[model samples]
Target: MAPRPNIIRIGMLVYPGCLRSGAVMPFDVFHIANTLSGLRVAANRVHFDTCWLSARKEKTLTVGGLSFHPQPADLEALDALMLPGIDHQGPYDLSPLLLGLGPEQEMLRRYAQTGKPIISSCSSTCLVAEAGLLDGRRATTSWWLAAYFRKRFPAVTLDAEQLVVEDGNHVSSGGVTSYLDLALWLVGRFGGDALRQSTAKVLAMDANRSSQAPYIAAAMIQDEGHAVIERARRWLNQRLDRTWNMAELAAHCHTSPRTLLRRFQDAAGMSPTQYAQQLRVERAKALLESTKLSLEDITGRCGYEDVSTFSKVFKRWARITPREYRARFGLRQ
Candidate 1:
């Protein structure tokens, strides 16, 4: 395509149930970028004009109960579009919001066909998935809803581990707060790497955050209502400090190893060995966050024989070292 125009027009789509921050944070970032661009020479400046658009012209209430009125705009004329996540407690809470967007799917599909970028953050990726644009494409959403999203849209490849997934003209971000990263990334895409970095520094955002792993809670992986899985989970939780043996664990759960593997995978989306490892890592995280124990002590308590092995495993699961995880949880490094 032709070089991106000097003047970029972006439209933010807002509905009654949209998250207030998600709807306005991008505007703030672009506004900041525009303010910064004013200081540069003409050749180095990038201009962004953003409009908040909604299907209805009347006043709308945000999920947080704040009143908002979005201006009417032409989606076809804009160079790009953004879909902020909706605020909801669970998948069922989103049913009404998703149903409300059913009328706009055709328009959204035509817009996607034009190949103009459509950026979605968190739960709003569901909107694009509903329009079928994400079919056979890699995408992500809030980490807590990964299993639900996968079940809802089997055609899309859902990787909740990613902070952002850019496939063709579709860019998706994970979690609610990732809209900041998404906004900074857009700045890089439109302006340059230097502008992106400067904006991140001004905003105090962690520029190196690329994975959702660090933020995922251990409880999210646990599935309830399966007797075999629950038994295995209880068994593993009680023995996080011990070396895992699949046959022994299977026997303890009162099932054959093959049956145990199949049932565990069906329930937890991972094999028995992987589940035990994650459980141990999660225990390590808990200890790191709550205890004043040294790394060597924590390692031994969490099943690892040495500090080095524990640190490596912890980094693999949490995407940060044990020390970093401790620091993040409010302990001074």
Candidate 2:
């Protein structure tokens, strides 16, 4: 028998004030991929060795109110180093952490020299910029901090409108939710589209939805109509497992069914029913990719009344059968 390939080691750097969402989201996504793949024989086995790297071994608090203790290792051994965002008030807010990052920065610089990937999200993009890794590179961050980032690092081109920006070995994403997009991209890059599709499916995300340009532009434009569309989207996202009808959705949005249909079409470029189905299909994809649950269970959980109907809808939307999609993207059962 052949020896198992080495698992990719991902080092997550958690500091005293790191954002919990930024640090934990990627970990959860990758772990789900590992779980789903392990259930089948032919699936590409992904071993994710996550170590929390800190300047000290003392207990640290996360911005989301979680406390953790990390290993004190030099960052050299990591296949990838993730710098989570911090809520820094100004330049002074980052000095302490930035001061101690010389060793970490050195490791990142060496990794860049060797063509390894370096990822940062939200305010963490500042760390990469400060390290001069993004000089003359296009990157992005949370819109609120875009101007400051451009001012602080004049050589780096900032695209505040993009959810995630990839420049060679460096990847940066906008806000907390955009971390999902960045994680999906990494899965696609290293693990292949099957893993990427599976991870996105598990997350209930739309792989067809470009994480860049028009989608981001649509998200940024906030008007009264946009607010209504957003409210409808939130309602749908929260009730993916429940059967949703056009009348019920219209009532929830305080409009007639026809008006709701027209507005939803204008806002999201799809009918409300179509939008709901899209969301369901996205959820179904995630379930298939991340869990060992039976097809029946996934269909029910994603609000399908019957497996036949569910399979048909999934195939129509995804352009492949669920089992085939799973086999292509996941390890064979």
Candidate 3:
């Protein structure tokens, strides 16, 4: 076996509106890994000392209303820092989520200046993006927020399909539960593959679940009360099985295609056709999850006539084959 690394200090940032699970569950995983490492090695080969840190050295409340009193972190001595996700209720309502995070961002900036690895999960990647750490870096977030993230942070390339992406010292993960995956990945990176695999088995988690595509829903694309976008959404929903070109959609919305495109880019953060495809994918997902329809029939119902074309599109949006999606989420009699 390789020589074990020194005791590593991991600081988890806790604050208001952050997901309680994202903040707390990874600690459990780390504890498990630490316990296993202590048992397996002579004289405690690897050690992870984790502590919760607040931005202001005070108690922080989570979105689920849990209060946390944490030790104030010494940012300079930390080996790694973690920024878990915050809570946002409605679709596309991230403006408020990024509020009150300035101090935390400054701390994160200071930590990054130390040239150590910084990890963020789910919506907390927004905070990382806002701090300018993700500028020119490849990152990802919860799949549903890909378009909105792209709109807000244009410099960072957002890959919505990936469950976790690591670029240099910055590591990011997608969705809520993906924090576990991020934790396990960190374990593997620092604690070795054996510890990672063993902890995953003990936790009954499939470490191979590496794509958010399987979990993304079209409804996650919130309208944010944009009149034109909502109208366009309804129009697309009513005719998901029919192919209506952008011209027809523009005509129905009573605007030129150029105007419609501009409004869609402003309101929905994607083009009209992209939104239409999203709706179609959502419809197909419904069929896959709730019906016994064959792939060909479902494809035709979802506006794709060719099976090859439909499968490719479905996999791109859903991140799994239609058959696999059905097997996992389908209603079993």
Q: List the global CA lDDT of all models.
A: 0.82, 0.72, 0.84
Preferred candidate (lDDT higher): 1 or 3 = 3
Question: Model 2, range 123-155, lDDT digits (tens) per residue?
Answer: 888888887899999999876565456556779
Model 3, 1-333: lDDT tens digits are 666745878889987778888888998999998888877756445778898888775565445668787786788988888878988875356776676788888888888999988999999999999889999999989877876788789899888789999999999999888989988987888888888998899999996777887787766655455778878888899998888888998888899999999998877667888888878888888998888988899999989889899888888778778888899999998
Steric clash pairs (candidate 3): none
Expressed as tens digits, the lDDT of each residue in 14-63 for candidate 1 is 77678889988898898888777767767778888888777664665355
Per-model TM against the reference: 0.91, 0.57, 0.87
lDDT of candidate model 3 versus the reference = 0.84
Candidate 3 residue 267 Cα shift, in angstroms, is 5.3
Ranking by TM-score: 1, 3, 2
Q: How big is the positional error of residue 209 in model 3, measured in Å on the Cα after superposition?
A: 2.3
Return the clash pairs for model 1, or none. none
